[model samples]
Target: MFMLKQQKAKIIDEVTKSLSNAQLILLTDYKGMNVENITKLRDDLRKVDAEYKVMKNTLLKISLTNVGLSIDDLSGSLEGTTAILYTDKDPVMALKVLYNFIEENGNIPVVKSGFFERKFIDQAQAKEFSALPPKEVLLAQLVGQIQAPIYSLHAVLSGMLRKLVYVLDGIKDKKPN
Candidate 1:
């Protein structure tokens, strides 16, 4: 049983370190997925700098309690082949990847709830996360919004310059130059 304890301790340490900088914690049940499918999922999450880890319920509880995180609301879902996804950056991209996986695979394992920024959100809220654009897209949108007024001001000033150009052209024609 010494080996068992050592495994648990390792898991606890891993969970603690992984969640320390994580902004989003997603819990999913990857029950029916085969090795290939799970590997694909892991690869997709890795692209977004997220990790997928399967843990024992007891160890998960111990780790969360140790790390000062509360999963009380999601405790019910910590059952039956649960795999946790921890993301320090771009939670939306990771969520979208899982959402798409579920969609493409006919929703077999099921997405439970998630811990986002210290708040426990239900599946509906998790769906909202999937609807969000990726970090790059959101940033680009914000930049576009911020630059719109400047572009409009430039266009207005250019219209006045065009009017002056027209006036000068008319004067030149009248002077026969």
Candidate 2:
């Protein structure tokens, strides 16, 4: 009994630390995934600086309170074999990794819910987040969007200059020396 309590306390401490530093905390229910699959998922998540841990919901709830984050909206998804996937950096990249895992693994590891940037997102919303493009890709798209107008302006200006040159050439040709 004492050992179990100690383990729970340690988990609470770790979860508290993780939550305090995380930009996003995703809850997954890996009910049917095997150990090999879970390890692969963990390695993949590690590439994006995210971590996956299976913890007791009670300990997690205690840890949430320790980190000063209310677990009010997370209760609905608390049941089952839960694994916490969290990253201190880009949540979108982390979500993309998780999404890829779910996609490749035939969706066994289900996305339960998420807390991102101080907002409680449900399963649908978590899935939506996973569907998002990576930060670099989105940023690149924005840059392309911004540059399209500039390229058009350049094309218009070049056309005007070409017309001016043609006009000057026509005037010179019409003149007799």
Alpha-carbon local distance difference test for all models: 0.83, 0.86
Model 2: pairs clashing at backbone N, Cα or C within 3 Å: none
lDDT of 2 by residue, 51-119 (tens): 998877777778777877778888877887888889999998888888888989998798888788767
lDDT of 1 by residue, 1-177 (tens): 234777778878989888877888888888898888888888988998998877777777777677677868877878777888889898888898888888888794478887887688888899998899877889999999999999999999999999999999999989964
TM-score of each: 0.79, 0.83
* lDDT (Cα, 0-100) at 167 in candidate 1: 100
Candidate 2 ranges with C-alpha deviation above 4 Å: 1-7, 104-106
Residue 143, candidate 2: Cα error in Å is: 0.6
Q: Which stretches of candidate 1 lie over 4 Å from their true place?
A: 1-3, 157-177
